[model samples]
Target chain A: MTRVRMDLFVSLDGYTTSDPTPDDPMGPDWGRLTAAYTATRTFRERIFGDTSGAGTTGVDDTYAAAFFEGIGSEIMGAGMFGLHTFPDDPDWKGWWGDRPPFGTPVYVLTRTAPRPSISMDGGTTFHFRNAAIGDVLAEATDAAGGQDVRVGGGIGTALEFLRADLVDDLHLMVAPIVLGRGLRLWDGVPALDRSHTVTTEVAESGTIHVTFTREQHA
Target chain B: MTRVRMDLFVSLDGYTTSDPTPDDPMGPDWGRLTAAYTATRTFRERIFGDTSGAGTTGVDDTYAAAFFEGIGSEIMGAGMFGLHTFPDDPDWKGWWGDRPPFGTPVYVLTRTAPRPSISMDGGTTFHFRNAAIGDVLAEATDAAGGQDVRVGGGIGTALEFLRADLVDDLHLMVAPIVLGRGLRLWDGVPALDRSHTVTTEVAESGTIHVTFTREQHA
Candidate 1:
């Protein structure tokens, strides 16, 4: 089955980010916040294109490797695709320089007008959509070709998918820091325990990897 | 040196408890939320006074037992002492019927009048105080007699101590549930990572025991 999975790097206080700025890119605390995730060998090899093969090979690395495995398509919001920062810039492909990490067909949910799809160097291609979550998920699921569809987040898009009960699996990497104020991931999702079978795995980096899979009913 | 510590049973979304009503004392999901904690032998013997010696002894029980050890005095908000639930009732000792677990001097932070202290059947003694966090902490510290002073919580109280930077050590038991709306524990607490070093341990009960300790500065 083509599952709808989400991977989020969240703070201990439940914030995804502190709001992006032009100077800070993802936000002021972006570097320190994603330290554990970026230190993984999988992140180095897959996301950063660090072909030198230098990175930590721990539990976090294992999860990082699995994050890129079997994911044929991705769905993300405009903010995640850098549209929030470069709304007026037509040439702005994404934050992921020349070689974007996502080698799958990526769908960007935005309110912008329909534009031609941007094909990156890798197998990745950007397709913009301004439709309901169901419609977008359907398109992304079909594009997945029986593989899993990874719902990339900036909190807003993740909340929308989770609120609509559209996510099959959710992997939340809880960083040790507390962001205090920002876009909280669990805003509208009430009583999530009743819906999912929850589990927690602690990494050597002190990140608590909590996974929630929707329960199957009889 | 004896450190002031805290132990909180919190939801995955960082909520301590939902709005408590008479119908739902610890909110609607209280039972499922603290199931593992309350099921421990330490909780059974100390809290429920169950002498039958029937309870699971595991990693969760290890933390549960540690929660009771190395604590001389306790500090909590009026709500945690059940003063909010039974505010008008002059005879309300606490939610713990007869033998309250806290054998140490338990100071309840409230704005009520200066009344005589209530000494329970156990070593627990309830004293009311309307002073500030500094004053109360000082009083509790003195009463601790070189032992640790536990800052017990109901979210609001814990936040007050945390915001004031009075807590030396904090242990948060992350339960696998989300109560979407409630008094959040992390509100107003920004850049907590700058002060504390955090670590996490996962139990068989699926609870993520996260600890934050103030880093010693030379």
Candidate 2:
């Protein structure tokens, strides 16, 4: 069976963004929050498209490699798709440029999803919908084929699926920093531990990796 | 040199107490939050006085042992001293009974502090004072001689020293569970990461131990 998985970057204090605005989306300390993950070799290759083989290896790299592995489809919110940035522009193809990182079917859940699915370079196709999260997940699950369906969060989208108890695997890349300000994750869903078997590990660079896997899926 | 150090129990969401009341002190999920620590051999020997050597050893046990070692004096809030539980009763020597946990001078910082120091059965002496935390720490430092001064927290007390940058070593025993509603520990202390060098480790039982030791002291 195909599993539903997600990976999120947060500080030790469980913050994602700091006083985020539409103009400055991720805020000032976004780099600090994602310092460890971005330092990984896999991140340098996958996200940055660096062919020079730069960035650190080992624990953080292993997790970074797993994030991009076996993911056939992705479901994200308007923010992640960059719909909020250029809502009026018909040519807005997200922040990932023409050659987007995800080489799979990407579903953008928004109230302002234009009409048709836009096919882009690098085997990527953007599907827009305003349907309920469960309905969207069903479509994404089907589109994933035998591979895993990944939830690409702006955090809000992921939490909605998480609160509904749909996510099978969740990994939190916790930076060894205290962001006393910003988005507070895990506010309402207190059964995180009860629903999943959690395993935590510390990387050499002080990044803490915490994974919660649902028993049936495991 | 005498160093100021502290160890606190918090959830992954950085919560200490949840919906706490005078009747139900630590709230409903206190037991669940402390499950791993309580399961440790050192905790069983120290806190429960279970000298039968009946408890799990290793990662959690090592941390539990360290919590009780190399500490000459302790400073805490009135709530931690059980003054809030039995305020009217003059003979109430705290919930720990006569042989309290700390075998050192335990300073109780309270506004309604009674006159004269009360010496207990053990090497423990309850010193009540309405003085500022810095002043109290000075006295505690003096009383500690060359040994470390430990700040025993009700969280609020700990944060006070933390925000003031008085603590040299801060160790957080982060339970794998996330308590959605509780006392938010790192609410205003954003500089916790900036001031100290952080290191995270995971125990076999899934309890995460994160330590923040000041670089100057290190």
Candidate 3:
């Protein structure tokens, strides 16, 4: 029983990301949006390789740890894969450095011509695909080997799967901020609680974790 | 200290209200947005006058109880008072019954000509005023007699006070649902945590209770 999972960080007002600059490609508000998640011990261990364990340990850390678990394959947009940032850089890999946090086969959905797969130092491999969402998901599912196929989003790609009803679990980390700009994640989606079992928890740092698990899948 | 407090119910997607009709003046999504708050024990006791104690008592009920406490006077928009629904009906006295919940001076902000104040059965008086937000707030404060002056909102009227930096405490009941439409309350407001002590707690009904208390006021 393979499940499609997605994790998104957004402001309380529903803004995902804001204006991007040369230094911060993800956007200026992206840091504020992801402050709680990044302030977790698990994030320091998995993302920054801080083995000293010098970060907040609570619900936020638990979610951060769960984010990297049970994900056997990944599906992300070209933006998440740094294609939008470094479009012409043939030598460019991704923002995740030589060894990305994902230790699985990652399918980067792009509209450009297909490029050869790139295997990193870790157990992660990036496969560029110029195909439809369903086709790409099928490939990602096959690569998952019955595990969860995680959607590594930049919001646009995640929304495509969500609007198409392909996601089984949608977890949103809402920071206590009023980001006046950027796109809302749940713009055209149906009320989640109607079809899914919605659960919410507040982290010690004031980040609200809301998860909508599909009732059928649950 | 006479703090200017406000309580708002909105979807997790930030929509305060959706397409309204003659039947549901607040909107179709109003019920969905306010389900958790309305289901609280305090709401059942205060709003509906249900003395049987037949409602959930949790973090939501605590907040619902606080909503009516210390609010000596309130200022609300004309829409919230059902002015838009019944323009010509001189006898229109709002959705709340003869004994309205707030036993205080309720100032109805409207552009129409001021009418004689309607004093309800249970200490509730509707004073129609067509003045600036500050002026009405000042009048409401004076009527409060050193107690807290609450901004009873329908989004439009609430934003006026919020934008004008008149509110010292803002509490939002964020239901775990996507409305997808209507107006966002914090569209242009700065990040709350920057100037206020923002706290979040999850109610048993999955409704996230976020309170932004002004640090200066605190």
Candidate 4:
């Protein structure tokens, strides 16, 4: 069975953005945080079809590359797929340009009607899954071969997996800053049972990297 | 005249929260980020009615205190006032407790029908404003005295003020992470010929602080 992992950076308060869309000022951090990936040979070759980023490195870049290299497929929430206003527009793909960073199949969870798969470069394909969480996970697993399946989170999608206890591992790079107000993680969910054990901790460049793995309950 | 300053911690890709509401794992970062405000004696006494805090006695306390002590009034967007599902609910107060952290008056920008003022202890009051941005800013300035009125941003509200060129200063603390998705700060706004001059840079244990004062355009 492929373990489900979720990896993302979260504020000290746990908001994904300042609003319901991906075009906010906070959006630029993605490029900055992922700058290391662009400086990697694997990242450039796999996603951008370029050989420019060979041998260049940083600790952040290495960590990110390792994480991305392990992922076989990605499942994202509908809000993560499109801006909140353009949720229903089939024409609008995503904020990422023609070739997205993810070089694997991307499953978008939405309540909208199903549509045909949109194929991009580097073997990446966007599959809209209107089915339940279980169905989506199963399809993504099948599409992922035997590798790990990552939940490309947007709070809503990650909560569904967390609520279902379908998530196996979690990696959060906590940035020490607060929005004071915005969308929040764990806003409407029930209190969680503390069974997960911290498996790793790495403090790097003003961010804390923490990993938690679910413990097997007898 | 009082200047309105919007302060927020956003992801690289831009998102206010991990989810629309607060129940997601990514939402916890917001709590940690806002916890910085509790570090100040004045802010702590005003918000929580106490001076003692858990592990808030060092340099962290000073930095946190400085961030919150400078703000005056707060402004937020309608979607940020509550969950999107409760758009029609007149009874939905914000996620904050009865007495919010802001000791000053708060403005909730919305097209919805304005409600009566919600007064709370510690001098925090909720006043719904449905007027134009200019009128709202003017009212907020009067309420703020000579202090900088802080726009309690939800991306949309911040972008609106940024579009109108009403914001005098912006304190954007970029977290070292990427949501890779979620609400963006400048999603639908028209481009502006604005330039930012970095006033201060502080690399702390958890995140870097970069303050930018909007430079006067030629």
Candidate 5:
């Protein structure tokens, strides 16, 4: 079964990322908001491309390593892919640069004109799609080759899949920082316990990891 | 030091409570949202008047027991005192019955006409005040007889104190439910790390106890 998974680093107040400003293309708040996750060994190796293994190998790294374990195909919003920051700049190859971290078939959800898919140095191939969550998930599943389909986010994209009940597992790392204002992730998400088995783990890094596994109902 | 303290039972998504309706005065959400808190021995005894020691005495109960410790008064919003549920009826003495809970001076922040103070069977005295958070906290601190001043909440009331940087110690229990909507407690509060030291402890009852102690600034 190709389960839909999501892993988001959110502020204590539910903000996943701050608005992108010219001074800070990735948003000045993203660093502080995602400090714990970015400090993990897996993040430094997989996401940051640091082969020196200089990151923490504690509880946080364990979860970070598990995040990319079974993921075969990735579906992300245009915002997460940096299109929201550089909508007019056609030269932007995403914030991840030439060799994107996601070594899988990536689906970028957008309503812009259909363009050719961009293949990165890694196995990552960015495919453009303009469809509802279900349709895109179906396409992502087919591209996943029976592996898990991961929903990469910028909050808005993740909520769309969650609200549609398409996500099977959600792992949210609650950082201690509180972004007073930004895009809230849990705004329209209904009481998850009604349909999911929710559990929590507190890491020594002051990050509370919350996982919501959707329950199979009769 | 008489630190201003707060202990709120909030959902995983940050909702403190739901709106009261005709059929369900406290709304259907409050019961499930407050299950962990209400099931504690301290809650069963203090809030429910259960003296049989029937409730669980776990990590949640330990925090529940500490919630009332200190020498002081309490500041609460009108909604928390049940005035919102029975706005037209002036006879409602709150949901705590005749004796009430707190054995100290209780200041209810309300915009209604100044009514005579109600001295419950217990030492609790309900004093209605139509003033800002600073003024009320000052009065509550003075009335507390040099002890701690607790800001009892239904979320909005607590946010008022937190936003003003008046609360010294905040202890929030994150319940397992995701109330899709309600009064969010962390809405306008900026990154707490800027002013407070945050720590988390997960209980056997699945409630994550988060504490934020105000840092002393020069």
Candidate 6:
């Protein structure tokens, strides 16, 4: 069974954007956070489809190499995929242009009906899944080839999984900022009794990295 | 004429929430950020409806107090008003309880037919408006009685006003977080020739305060 994990950066105040969207005002810090993930040669080559300038060396790069090593496939919510309405037209690819960042098979959960899969460079393909969360996770896990399944979030999708206890390991990088208002991460979920045991904590120049594993209920 | 100013705290890259919704792994910093705002008397009283200990003595407190002092009316997007579907139910008040933060009139912009105004405690009333952005701003300004009109956002509504160039002053308190995905502010707006002059920049305990005034175009 592939363990599902989630990795993302958030503000101290639980907001992701200052204007209800994903654009944050903290520039270099945000770049540093992304650099942490993009620094890894394997991760970069796989996601960006560009092997040039591949062997970058940095603290974030080293950590990113380790982070991406275990992931097999990814599942992202419709909102995380794009701001445009789901069942997007054929002309509308995504923010990542013709070559998206994810090289592996990606499943986008939406309310739309079945559509043809989108193929991009670097072996990346996008498949829209309108089924329930459990079915989508199962499909992603099977496609992952015994590797861990990663839940790339848009807050709403992450909550859906959390409510179903589908996520296994969690890694969150806290940025020191606050969005007074926007889409909050935990706005509507019912509280759960599960406890998280901190596995690791690291403070980098851009963000504070913390990893948590859900403890088994007594 | 009343100036419409929007004051908000954003990250360097321009994200408003750590996660798009309120269910991701928001760490301990969330509490700290919430405390930063709740420490302010105006914010506290507006959201929680508790007027106890509402005083501006410290420098941070003074800045927050002055920022929210003279807002006559508020304009919010459909998402910010409530999660309910528009033109479906007129009874859905909002996420906030009976007494919302704003104690004046609130105009909610939508594409559907307008609903009758619903009065609330503390002199707050909710009025649904399906008019054009200019019309809504005009109505809000007229209702403001010479006081500044505060434009509350959800992303869609904020961009509408920014694209229309109806806002006079924009205050963004840059927090130090980045959400790599979600609704982005200024996403689809065309690049304009307008310029903004920084009026003030302050670094508080947790966030940086920056104010920008749009220069009048000839």
**Which of the predicted structures, 5 or 6, would earn the higher lDDT when compared with the native?**
5
Which portions of model 1 show Cα errors greater than 4 Å?
Answer: A22-25, A215-218, B22-25, B215-218
DockQ of 6: 0.02
DockQ category of candidate 3 = medium
Looking at candidate 5, what is the lDDT of residue A177? 73
The residue-by-residue lDDT of candidate 4 on A1-218, one tens digit each, is 57788876665445555544444534544443344334555666656667665645554455556676668899998778774647557687776778787778999998878878888866678988889999999999898898889997677788788767777777766554444344555444332324455432333344445555666521
**List-wise, what DockQ does each model earn?**
0.78, 0.71, 0.71, 0.03, 0.72, 0.02
List ranges where model 6 is wrong by over 4 Å. Answer: A1-218, B18-35, B51-59, B83-88, B188-194, B215-218
Q: Which residue pairs overlap in candidate 2's backbone?
A: none
Which fraction of the native contacts appears in each prediction?
0.89, 0.79, 0.85, 0.00, 0.81, 0.00
For model 4, residues B1-218, the per-residue Cα lDDT tens digits are 46667777664334555554533423644654444444445556555667465444553456556657656787877766673547666777777787777888888887877788888876888898889988887788788887768876666678878767676666655444444345555444332312544432333433335454656522
> Residue A208 of model 5: what lDDT?
89
lDDT tens readout by residue for model 2, A36-145: 88988899999888979889898999999999899989999988877777778888788888888899999999997465888889988999989999898889889999
lDDT of 5 by residue, B17-50 (tens): 7765544544678778678888889988988779
Candidate 1 local lDDT, B62-96, one digit each (tens): 98999999898999988788877877888889887
**Consecutive 10-residue window with the lowest summed lDDT within model 2 chain B:** B187-196
Cα lDDT tens digits for candidate 6, B1-218: 57788865454345454444432222233443344455677766656656797743454566677677889999998777764333355588876787777888899887766677889977788888988988988899899999888888766677787767677777655443433343445444422223545433333444545455666621
Residue pairs clashing in model 3 are none
Q: Candidate 4 chain A vs. true chain A: TM-score?
A: 0.78
- Candidate closer to the true structure by lDDT (higher is better), 3 or 5: 3
